[model samples]
Structures are given as C-alpha cells and as structure tokens.
Target: MKNHNVFIALLHYPAMAKDGKIIITSFTTMDLHDIARPARAYEINTFYIVQPVDAQRYIIQKQIDYWLSEEGRKTNPTRHEVVSMVKLLYTYDEVIEDIQKNRGTKPVVVGTDARPYPKTVSYQFLREEIEKRERDFLIVFGTGYGIPPDLMATFDYILEPIYGAGDWNHLSVRNAAAIILDRLLSRNRC
Candidate 1:
C-alpha cells in the first residue's frame, strides 16, 4: 500500500500522527488487544510477515474475531477493511523473491523493529537512506515464533529498539507496526 494512505488511516485515531511516511511497529504479546486498531489501520498497506504454521486457520479465525470486536470496531468502520488490507502471506522464498523484484528500482524500505541485533544494522542503514531520498518503502513482519534468521537478514533496517513500560513481555507485532508508522509519518512535512 502507498505510505500516505496508511498515514491517513493511522491519523483516524487521535493518538497517531496525521502526516508523512508510515513504517511497521510491533506490539507485545500481551498488548495485542491494545494495538489491534492501529495495526489494522497501518496494515492497509503494510505487509504482515508471519510464520508458516499448521494452525493457520485458527490463527486467521482469531484474527478475524479480534478485528470484529469492540476495539477493532472503534478504530475501523467494519471488519472488511481490516480483512481486505492484508496483502500477502509468504514463506522465506517468496519474501526473497519479492525483495529481488524491487531491488535497485523503486525505493523499498523494510522495517524490522521487533528485535534488536547488530545483524539488522545494514538493512536499517539502507532503509534510512531510502527514507532520506523520499522513496517508496516496504515493511515485513514475522509471526508464529519469530522471524526466521534469513528473513530478518533481508530487512532494510531493524528499528531502534525501545523498552515497553508495562508488564507486557514485548510490544505486539501490531503495536510495533504502529510505532514504525508513527516515526515514518513524523519525517514528512507535507
């Protein structure tokens, strides 16, 4: 999805920003409920990179329930918006192919903000450069357990890790995307 449209969706909530680029943000496992709305808003254009599991049906059902609940309704007009926003579900090979397709042509920024590791530095640098140039960006998230090492290696940058204030173990993937989107939007003046 285009970054600007994602930014506008996020702005629907008073807490999120109203302008600029949008990147992915993570939510702690426990706070998935809190982050669901912002995540749905950003998911309009953001790619959700999840692990391949046998329980895909169950997980998708749970996600549907989460999106249709009161919290999701408060943030989005209807569940279909969230359902339609999900664009791709890929294995590692597909992700590699997707990256290859965009390399050296359009600016593609990948955000991996969930984990903090030096390995993510290179991608992070590349992402920063893409943003500095005001180009198109793409973000990837990993689910199931965590992002595979190989996929993580493909990110343009790992977000600067932040410690959550609450009891949550870590930010949920949804909230993490919101944070990334928030930062991206903060960068644009238009």
Candidate 2:
C-alpha cells in the first residue's frame, strides 16, 4: 500500500518575518523540486504547497502542469514523478481537510521549527509514533522566518529543532525536510 499516512506541507502564508510580523512569504521555485524529491523518497504520497495569493498559485500550478506533461516527462521523468505528489492549497486548514478526507481520520498535526516550543517532541518519539502506523501525521514546515507563534501553538506536536555540531542553526526548508523524513521513516537509520 502507498504510505499516504504521513504528509508534509510547505507553508508560504502566515509565516513570521524577520521583523516578527505575520506575512505571506514569496515562493522559491526550486523548493518544490528539492522538497518533493525527498517526500517521494520517503514514500510520502502528498506534499502540500500552501500559498494564499492567486497569482503565485497560478505560477506554481503552471510549473506543475508542465512537469506533469508528456514533454516535460521526456525531459526528466524523475522530476515528473516527484512533482506529481504535490497538492496545492490556499490555507493550512485546507491541508488538514484534505488529509482527513484521504485518511478517514483527523491527522495528528506536527509543526517544525528552528526553536523549541512548549509542546516540542523529540524525533525519536515521533519516529516511533509514525512507526505504529495507527494515526496519520501532517508535518507543517514554514518558508520564512518560521511559522508564526500563534499558528505554531495550534499544532499537536512541535518537533525539536535540528541541531548540528556547531552553533549555527538555520537550515534551508528543503534540507530540513529531507533530514526530518530520513529520521522519521528511514529503515536503515543508525
């Protein structure tokens, strides 16, 4: 069976700016390609790109259309496969609704961040929870500074931030998604 239980969303709206204001962040075209590759590798069947602007959504949809087209597939079949998993939505609520419809149950919503939240859960705990395969999970990842504080509070579980050897902590959303997926779903994890 397809592993449609675990989903990841890349949110462009309601993200925090450096000035600490909620804003709709601009989409990075390559983020779709980079993040979708890992989502496919991890057997995650649905990848959500949440953007509220109509024009931005149109541009993204256009790119998706081309990738799903036969000509684009001829150019790169692997990309076509990866891009096929993307589901465009306007709001975070819509993402939840879609997952619920697919799984027949409300997913245990999880949020990702570079900072710790009161409800933050360890990767080990989440990995084991996902392994149970009894409940669906939707991991929400933000595009700007991070998901706003008010929005982050709504998630059921906030994953502990990924930390490297050094003090620096910022990671591109695409890289973060791959590492988080490997940690949660990889069979050969050490």
Candidate 3:
C-alpha cells in the first residue's frame, strides 16, 4: 500500500510581480523539463501546470504531446518517463477535482513563498505530519514574486522560505520546487 500521496502545482496567474502587483506570468518552457524531472524523481503523483491563457495552454499542451511522442521518447528516454507525469490544467479548482477523481479525496493545499514570513510550517514538521496521515497534498509553487496574499490565504499550509549562504532568498520556482521536494519527501538530503 502506498503511504504517501503528493502532487505539484505551478500557478502562473493570480501570482505576484516584483513591483508587488498581481499579474499573469508567462509560462517558462524550460520549467516543463526542469521541474517535471524533480516531480518524477521525488515520486510526486502529479505535476500540474495551471495556466488560464488559451495560447499558453495550447503551447504547453503541444510541448507535453511532443514529450509523449516517439521522437521525444527517442531523444531522451529518461526525460520521457518524467514528462509523462505532467498534467496541464486551467485553475486550482480543476487540480482539486482531478486529484479527487483519481485519489478518491480532496487534497490538502500547501504552498511555498520566498518571503520570510513567520507562522510557516517547517519542512521537518510537514514530513512527519504527512507520514502520520493518510492524506493527499497539493504543493503549489508560485510563478512570480510568489502567489499573492489572497491565494496564500487559501493554502492549508505555507512552507517557510529556503535560505542560501547570504541574504538572497529569491529562487527560480523550478529550483525551489526541487529543493522543497528533496527536503520534505526524501531521506534528509541535508
């Protein structure tokens, strides 16, 4: 029996900009390969990219289809396995519905941010809690300055920002998602 159920979500709209404005960020093509690799490696059940734009969604779908193609499979067999886990969705609610349909339950929504905020759940605590419950989780990564306050308010838990050697806290969402999975899902890599 599987003891863990985890999903990854990338929120492109309803996110923030450096100027503290809410904006729709463009989807980064590299993130499909970069982030999906970590999601597959870390055993996440689903890698979801939530973008509402029609053109952006079309492009992402095409890319995903390519990765599922014979040429894509021949180009890099390993990445093909990873990309197979991706699911393109239009919004957060759709993600919930998909998980519920597949997993038979709604997932607890977890989020991450670069801002140093108190009352954030520690990675250690979250890992232990996940081990204790038979619950599913949707861990969301923001596309810009991080998901805005209103969106953050909807998360069941928000993980604390990861720190580097200096005061630098900003990390590309792809890198941040990878680190979060390593810290929370795997044998302590630190």
> Candidate 3, after superposition: displacement of residue 72 in Å?
1.4
Error of 3 at 42 (Å): 0.9
The digit string of per-residue lDDT tens for model 3 on 9-93 reads 9999878898989988899999999999888877778899999999999999998998899999999898889899999998878
lDDT of 2 by residue, 1-190 (tens): 2466799999999899999999998889999999999999989869999999999999999999999999989999999999999999999999999988877889999999999999999999999898788899999999889999999988999999999998788999999999999899888778
For model 1, the stretches where C-alpha displacement exceeds 4 angstroms are: 1-36, 39-44, 49-51, 58-76, 88-90, 95-115, 119-135, 164-169, 186-190
What's the TM-score of every candidate structure?
A: 0.50, 0.97, 0.93
Stretch of 10 with least lDDT, candidate 1: 7-16
Compose the digit string of candidate 1's lDDT tens values, residues 1-190.
3343221111111111123222222322333333444545444343333334435435554665666677877776555455444333324444445444644343343545445766454434543554464554555544334444454565555655545676444655556666665555444434
Quality of model 1 by C-alpha lDDT: 0.44
Decreasing TM-score order of the candidates:
2, 3, 1
Evaluate residue 39 in candidate 2 and report its C-alpha lDDT on the 0 to 100 scale: 93
What C-alpha lDDT values do all the predictions have?
A: 0.44, 0.92, 0.86
Judging by TM-score, tell me the better candidate of 2 and 3. Answer: 2
Q: What count of clashes does model 3 give? A: 0
| 129 Cα displacement, candidate 2 (Å) | 0.4
Sorted on lDDT, highest at the top, how do the candidates line up?
Answer: 2, 3, 1
